[model samples]
Target: MACGEIITEPLMVAAIDLGTTFSSYAFATRGEFKDDPTKISSYAWCTGSQPGLSLKTPTCILFDKVQNFFAFGAEAEDKYTELAQGGGPHTLVLL
Candidate 1:
C-alpha cells in the first residue's frame, strides 16, 4: 500500500432475474442499501398490450435471419406477430 493512494469503485449494485416466462431487474446503491435494505428498488417494465406497467416482461426476443436484433418483451411480441402475419422470416428466442 502506498502512503498516498486512492481506490475508486462503483457505488451501486444490481441484479437481473431471467425466468422462463418473465424477467426482472433490480438495483441498489451502497449507501441506500446500507441505510435501509428496503431501499433496494425493482423496476416495472412497460408493455405494448394492456394497460399499466408490469413487474416483469415476457422472456422473448425477435431477430432477423442473420441474428440482427429487432425487439424485446411486448414490443417483440407485437413485431413478431406482425411479421408472422406477413409471412416474413425471423427468429424468436423464448426462454
Candidate 2:
C-alpha cells in the first residue's frame, strides 16, 4: 500500500426493463450484490386512473408542442387525459 495511492469505492449498479407497454428499474449496491445477488429493489408505480400501485408503469410519454418533456407512466396518462378532456396543447406517445 503506497501513501500516494488513491482509494476507490465500488459503484452501484442498476437494471432497466423497457417493455412495449411497461417500464421498470431495479438497483443494488456492488457489495450487496456480491453478498446476495437477489437483493435488488424496484418501485411500485401509480396508474393515474387506477386505485392501486403497479409493478411497472405504462410506456406512455408526454411532451409539449415545443418539444418540452412533460411526464411518463401514469402521470403521462393523466396529463394526456387532461389534454384530451380540456383540449390543451400537447403530444402523447402511447405504446
Candidate 3:
C-alpha cells in the first residue's frame, strides 16, 4: 500500500518466545504471526536485536561498589570496582 493507503484483511492470536535465561512473550494481533526471533540486545533501537529484554543483553550492566571480583559469574562485582575507581584500561582491561 501507499502512504495514504488503508490496511484491510487481518489475523488474530500470536505465540512468542523470549529465549534462554529469560521468559517468553505471546499475545494477539490482527494480521500475520511472528514466531521468529526478534532478539533485543542493548539500550538502543526497538528493532533488529534489541535483546535489552532478553538474555543476550550483554553483561554490560556495571556495578560500582565492591572490589576484587575474579570468580566466574562474578562480573557484576568486577565491573563495580572498575567503574567506581574511574580508572583507565590499565586497571580494567589489563587485569
Tens-place lDDT per residue, model 1, 12-84, is 8899999988888999988897799788788788876667899898888877667778788877887777767
At residue 82, what lDDT does model 1 achieve?
73
Best by lDDT: 2
**The best candidate in terms of TM-score:** 2
| Candidate 1 least-lDDT 10 residues | 86-95
TM-scores of the models, in the given order?
0.71, 0.74, 0.18
TM-score (C-alpha, index-matched) for candidate 3? 0.18
Per-model root-mean-square deviation over C-alphas:
4.6, 4.8, 12.6
lDDT of each: 0.78, 0.80, 0.37
Candidate 1 stretches with Cα past 4 Å from truth are 1-10, 87-95
- Which pairs clash (backbone N, Cα, C closer than 3 Å) in model 1? none
Local accuracy of candidate 3 as per-residue lDDT tens digits, 55-83: 22222333223534432212433454555
Candidate 3 deviant stretches above 4 angstroms:
1-8, 13-15, 31-95
- Give the higher-lDDT candidate: 1 or 2: 2
